[model samples]
Target: MIILVAYDISDPGRRDRAAKLLQSMGLSRLQRSLYAGRGGAAKARDIARALERILDSETDVADILVLPDHAWSRRIEVGNGRARVPGRARPPGVHIA
Candidate 1:
């Protein structure tokens, strides 16, 4: 499965920490606050727990979205520039939807 991890953290320090943590967990950065990678349900749960430990519930929000294999196959790419999905080699210059 493909996991999409996104977070909104108000504090710069906490945000940087979260980003580093996510990278350490094998998630690849997709955007400033968005990460994506392949991981199982167990991994997802572990990641959530780890994130929760460092994030302030009062001011920070984070989520992990699991994209099914079927949905991944049906993903649409609609731009001229290409993006790469973690752990997979895809054609260059297409954005997966």
Candidate 2:
């Protein structure tokens, strides 16, 4: 139930705003422009909805990946020295909807 949230926000102000909103929703800043959290489907949905509201105010592209429990233990890392939570069992499964 660890969710990986990534953002490609260009505006610092809006990016900070979005980060704050996500943090308020129980997400921890795991790396720059990346967030992590553990929650159920309802919480995930709520976070997605709130993220959309924040992203709507800007031109940034934000994505959320609901990582399954099985992938939580897998050791995959991103470029910025942060471990990657399996975003999807299949490639390009980023939940933007």
Candidate models: Cα lDDT each: 0.79, 0.70
- Score residue 59 of candidate 1 by CA lDDT: 91
Clashes of 1: 3
Which candidate should be chosen as best, given TM-score against the real structure?
1
Per-residue lDDT of candidate 2, residues 23-95 (tens digit): 8887877667887777777887787788777674456787778888667656354343324533313222223
Give me the runs in candidate 1 sitting further than 4 Å from their true place.
73-97
Error of 2 at 8 (Å): 0.8
Candidate 1 per-residue lDDT, tens place, 19-74, comes to: 89999998877667877778878889999999999999999999898888667666
Q: Give the TM-score of candidate 1.
A: 0.76
State TM-scores per candidate: 0.76, 0.70
Distance from true location, Cα of 19 in model 2, Å = 1.0
lDDT agreement of model 1 with the native = 0.79
